[model samples]
Target: MTVLATPHPTGHPGYSETLPREPESAAVARRLVRTALAAWGLEEHIDDAMVVITELVSNAVEYGRLASIRVVVTRPAKHRVRLGVVDRSRTVPMMRTDSNGDRIRGRGLVLVDSLTERWGTDLHQWGKQVWGELKCEPPR
Candidate 1:
């Protein structure tokens, strides 16, 4: 039962939640992301948000070494939406792909990078936050 908040400028809308570091957190994250984004009428972005949520949360659950997981959703004016996840691990962040013939278990951030307009990380107490942004607008 953790309440999360985000600072937004004008014309910004968002939602965030925190859950225990339990195995079911992933499922809960998926559901929460879908429900939150449904109001925006962006099912595609919602789906992507779900996937990104799973990956980010999974990483945190697996390696966060924290007590809970934090997730955020923001619609910053227009059709721009941002999804973020935070945990208690300060290992920075990295995205690896099988194409490099390296290990074979880290592709979460890779998918996020391909699907979101912008994605990055931020350091917090004991851990870091990973965020992905999606823009619903005409082609640039």
Candidate 2:
């Protein structure tokens, strides 16, 4: 159920790409984001964003199927950028914790939740979009 639709309209601009649901593509995407962030002078958040992107894509590749996954990067403005990875799956993801309250494997979301000011998933008539907003807060 891969789809072709216009991405969200933002002020700064954005780009979309259909990536093969594979581990290798995640690295390539990370590099792309890193480069873009560098140019945006937001390199500091690049790695964290990449990590979350990788996790999101990896999860989609592993669990979500029967649809093409799309990565939408929106540079709304300086000091902020939004990344969304969309899929066909309707299963809403969550930040799960184990019995001991020690998460060994489901930490992808825990990390994502902690890093960004806010993040969420988009599931509409089209598909599911996992998105996060990165704030360009300078280091203390």
Per-residue CA lDDT of candidate 1, range 1-140, in tens?
A: 54343444213336678888776988887877786666556676666778778877877788777688888777765667777788888887788755766656677789889888888988866678888887765233
Query: What C-alpha lDDT, on a 0 to 100 scale, does residue 71 get in candidate 2?
Result: 74
Q: Give the CA lDDT, 0 to 100, for residue 2 in model 2.
A: 29
lDDT values of the candidates? 0.74, 0.71
Error of 1 at 135 (Å): 1.6
Q: Which stretches of model 2 miss by more than 4 angstroms?
A: 1-13, 99-103, 137-140
How close is each model in CA RMSD to the real structure?
Answer: 3.9, 4.7
> How do the residues 47-81 of candidate 2 rate in per-residue lDDT, one tens digit apiece?
78898788777777776766457777777755678
lDDT, residue 98, model 2: 50
